[model samples]
Target: MEYITLNNGLKMPIVGTGTNTYGKENNDYNGEVKNEIPELVSALELGYRSIDAAISYRNEELVGRVLAESTVPREELFITTKIPANEEYISSKEATRAAIDNSLKNFRTDYLDLLLIHHPIEDKEQLKNTWEVFEEYYEAGKLKAIGVSNFGKNQLDDLKKFAKVKPAVNQIQINLKEPNKELLAILEEEGITPVAWGPMKTEAHQQEALDEIGKSYKKYGAQVLLKYQIQRGVVVIPKSHNRENQAANIDLFDFELSAEDVEKVENL
Candidate 1:
């Protein structure tokens, strides 16, 4: 797998697995948490070392159990989890610290590879308190990295006001449907990596074009789409239940998209 160097000199995998719906009944995001997540096991078996999880997903213990029990050593896995912006989590510095400690326990790890604020905290004091807590953990060596998700430019600017450590990445939706061109440029300018969630969303026409482009490389449209994102320095966490699709998602290092084809995808 490819890697991107963060501003803090840490390396993150360019591709990872999104586990928002894993370990849930009927694979539903809001379903009850089950004891096992066969998909996560399959993903690890297929050479996926990066696992993206969140507290709001409500399956942290299961996902953490699978990771802790996997043959892959703890040092090799890149585990990322988010703390929600709700009052229960960010109401006070102590509250945020408790949430982080709980997440670490749920993951069965001493340190997280990355932690993020699930959403922007509207209250300035709450935002400052939450971020300061994150900074505390980061300094204490409990969190390897800290960042934010679904934040617009204004929120990011607000964060910059008193942030001691700049965000390493901004997790956002980036696909042909919602390219987020302007924000992406801003992230690029700021030296912050952009992690794309829901990366496979695209129109039928776009998929047809990607298929045509992939024909020569013997790849699928999904592969081409992911390649487009990573080729442009964006990290993509594309989730799939099918084992074959899981393997295909990580099988992205063999071929390179030509500049002309890349431009075509950009225009799409």
Candidate 2:
């Protein structure tokens, strides 16, 4: 329900739907989770305007189908997808173009709100070349904005050095328990919006504190956790199949967390 203006001068939802499924660690890319369709539909019904997906997630086709059938007009939705760093795909201009084309076809959209280099290439030269192409796509209007995911400060520096267009966002796994403050500071200094992928599953988050904080705002622990990230100026995409949870993630604009409460959550 909140928004962040990216370095590229575009507004991105501060909270959205993340579509990575279970068993993603086991190489089960795109296992066809039938629930995502209804989950996304329900998210839209509940006022979620953003959908974060990636090529490696393997559910683009189905998600696209849901997007096509949803009652909300396409312009109202913010869609983002990524290109994996695998050699086969980014080996050449032709392959990269093909991969992006496939995403457009799958999403059933003419353009994407954002696109990212899904992961950093181990090879810096290759990474540089890949980013150049992404910039080309941005210039051509194939992608509205481009960014990187799971990149460390060093890699970000390299990309920034050669970049014609600065990255709009950087998505990584960050939570209240272990906030990765060093990287967060770097991103803040660089003017790139930080996006938290797994904002809820934090090992250090204080449940008692979260529950208590939620009481003052009539929110739950998960909502409090998400609110912490939003208040600190990070974007979040917390996915859920449960309608109640989906609604809670977007129902975050009503109240603001006090600086004292936010600091308490951070210290926890």
Candidate 3:
């Protein structure tokens, strides 16, 4: 798999798997945790090293157990999990510290590859406190990198005012349905990597166009969509339960999209 170098000089896989529904009943995001995630096992077997998880998913312990139990060594895996913005996690500096500590315990790791605030903290005091705690962990060598998810320019600017270390990445929705062009440009200007969630969500017409483009390269529309994002220096975490689809998600290094085809995708 290809990698994106973050602002902090750390390398992250350009393609990863999202685990919002892993270990949940009926594969539902809000479903109860049932203790096993065969899909995660399948993903690891299929060569997916980047695992995106969050506290809000309510299955961190289970996900962490699977990772700890897997044959893949910790050094070879890129594990990313988020701390929720709720009071339970971000109410105080100590609270945030405890939350992160618990997450480390759940994952059975000495250090996490990356940790992010699940959402923008509207209260400036809370935001400052949370970020400072993140900085503390990062300095202590527990969290390799710290960042924010679903943050707009205003939030990022707010954080920048008191932040000594800049955010390494901004995870946001970047599918064709919500391209987020302006924010993407801002991230580019600021030297921050953009990680796209819901990358496969596209209109039928757009999918058809990608399919036509993929024919020349002998790839699927989903592969073309992911390649488009990575080609432009954006990281994509597209998850799939189907083994074939999982294999296809990471099978993106074989070909390159021409300038003309890229423009066509851009216009779409």
TM-score of each: 0.99, 0.93, 0.99
Query: Candidates' lDDT values, in order?
Result: 0.95, 0.84, 0.93
Report the number of the highest-lDDT candidate. Answer: 1
**Deviating ranges (above 4 Å) for candidate 1:** none
All candidates: CA RMSD in angstroms?
A: 0.6, 2.5, 0.7
Tens-place lDDT per residue, model 2, 149-233, is 9999999988878899989999988986557899999999999999988888755337877888899888997888888889888
Shift of residue 31 alpha carbon in model 1, Å: 1.0
| Collision pairs in model 3 | none
Off by over 4 Å in 3: none
Q: Give the candidate order by descending TM-score.
A: 1, 3, 2
Better of 2 and 3 by TM-score: 3
* Candidate 3: Cα lDDT at 117: 91
* N/CA/C clash count, model 3: 0
Q: Output the TM-score of candidate 2.
A: 0.93
